[model samples]
Target: MDIVVFFVASGCAIASAIAVVAQKNPFVSALALLANLASLAALMLLLEAQFVAAAQIIVYAGAVMVMFLFVIAYVGPRGEIGGGVRKPWLVALSVFAALLIAVEVIVVVFGASLGAVASVDTDYGSPAAIGKALVTDYLLAFEVVSVILFMAAVAGVVFGTGGRPVRLSTEQVLAKEGESAVARRREASRAALDAARDSTTGESAR
Candidate 1:
């Protein structure tokens, strides 16, 4: 039963991931990514990592996927050929590296068991233990992650907003306005000088 569940979850994850890459529409790709996250969360559950599974669902499937969807929607609908194959070699290299890493992880963790390994107690997804580790040993890292998340939120707001001049200091705004006025005056002066030169040339010719 565990094997069946694992295979099913793995297949779902792979299928959804492929769909994410294969879909032409940005919205459809985002939805496929959401499906992939949900499938991965279910895979974590099957491994008895309840806390990790919940985190996957809450943090990734819920929050991150929603953000991705929001970005797609805010960016407006793209044409079919929005993103082109500009860097095929780079993409190929990245895919190769990812596959190499996946193979290395499989060999290191489950080479003996033919990729099947039983979950241990120490590896159990206990929320209390996770909390203790996060707050005690990894407190700085946790705080850094929180800061990164905050920055991401701020960036989203900044990028998604329409173009507008942000509020500046009074002195800065005044300086900019004065500079514009000066530029206009200079342009008018140049135009008047050119007209005067043309008129003088015509009178001399006459």
Candidate 2:
């Protein structure tokens, strides 16, 4: 039963990973990533790392994926490229990747040693143990990750602005609208004057 569940989760993870890369739509890719994360969580659960599995689901599949979807929504999904294969380099890269995968498979099948599974303590992957390690041994790494996340949020906001002002005052918006209206009216009057002049010239010629 464990073997069956592991295979199923592994297959789902592989499929979802492929879908995440193959799909051109960012939104669909994000959904595939969520599926992949969920599959990974299942694998973690099978390993008896319940805390890790729950964190994977809550932090990655839930919170991170929600943020990804929101960003995709805000940026708007991009249309697929409308041309034939443009990059000749990608063909070579794909071939190289295929060969690498083949080598890995061969190594796993014959070159790998069959070793006994290692044993772990009952609390090895528990939340308590992880929390203790985080606060004691890995506190610097934890704080660093937090700072990196804060920086990433700041960077996202900056890039999303796309050189535009983040906020506009009501008066500024009204002024810009008024200027646009004036420009449109001016353009219309100029077009009308040109049409009238052309008609007058035609009449004189006749």
Candidate 3:
């Protein structure tokens, strides 16, 4: 049963990871990443790391993915790129990546014996022990992560608005609305001119 579940999770994870890269749009890539994270959580469950699995789902699949989706929503969809398979830079990058992969595979094939290096304690992967380690030993790292997240949020707000000022007052908001109204009026005038020209042409023909 565990084997089956592991295989399923692994397959899903692999497929979703591929989808994350193969997707051209940021929103679709984020969805793929969410699926990959969920499958990884399932894999952690199969490994009997219940706490890790729970954290993976709650922290990564839930919180992190929510952030990803928020950013994607704010950015909107990516514009389409026009280029044939003849993109030189992409071809070069692919060849370089393939060569790197081949070298890594060669090294792994000729690597030392894969033996158990050390025995893990019974409760090594338990939630309680990990929590203790995080608070005691890894407190600095935890705080650093928090600070980084705060900075990212600040940066997102700055960049997401494209440096536009937030129109909090009614006058400013109305001015922006007026600009849009002017654009709409211009479009309407152009459309009306085209319709009148067509009518005049038809009348003359008749």
Residue-wise C-alpha lDDT for candidate 3, range 105-202, written one tens digit per residue: 98997795778656666786789988998899999999999999899999978877696776456456557677676668679999999999999999
The 10-residue segment of model 1 with minimum total lDDT is 110-119
Q: Which residue pairs overlap in candidate 1's backbone?
A: none
**lDDT leader:** 2
Q: Which whole-number lDDT from 0 to 100 does residue 124 have in model 2?
A: 82
Error of 3 at 94 (Å): 2.9
TM-score of each: 0.64, 0.72, 0.66
Worst 10 residues of 2 by lDDT: 77-86
Look at candidate 2 and give me any clashing residue pairs.
none
Q: For residues 92-122, could you state the per-residue lDDT of candidate 1 as single tens digits?
A: 9999999999999988876565554665786
Off by over 4 Å in 3: 78-86, 102-106, 117-122, 165-206
How much does candidate 3 score in TM-score? 0.66
- Candidate 1's TM-score reads 0.64
Residues 35-124 of candidate 2: C-alpha lDDT, one tens digit per residue: 999999999999999999999999998798998888788767444443236477997898799999989999897877868778998988
lDDT (0-100) at residue 61 of candidate 3?
78
Q: Which ranges in model 1 have alpha carbons more than 4 Å from their true place?
A: 86-123, 165-206
Question: Candidate 3's C-alpha lDDT?
Answer: 0.83
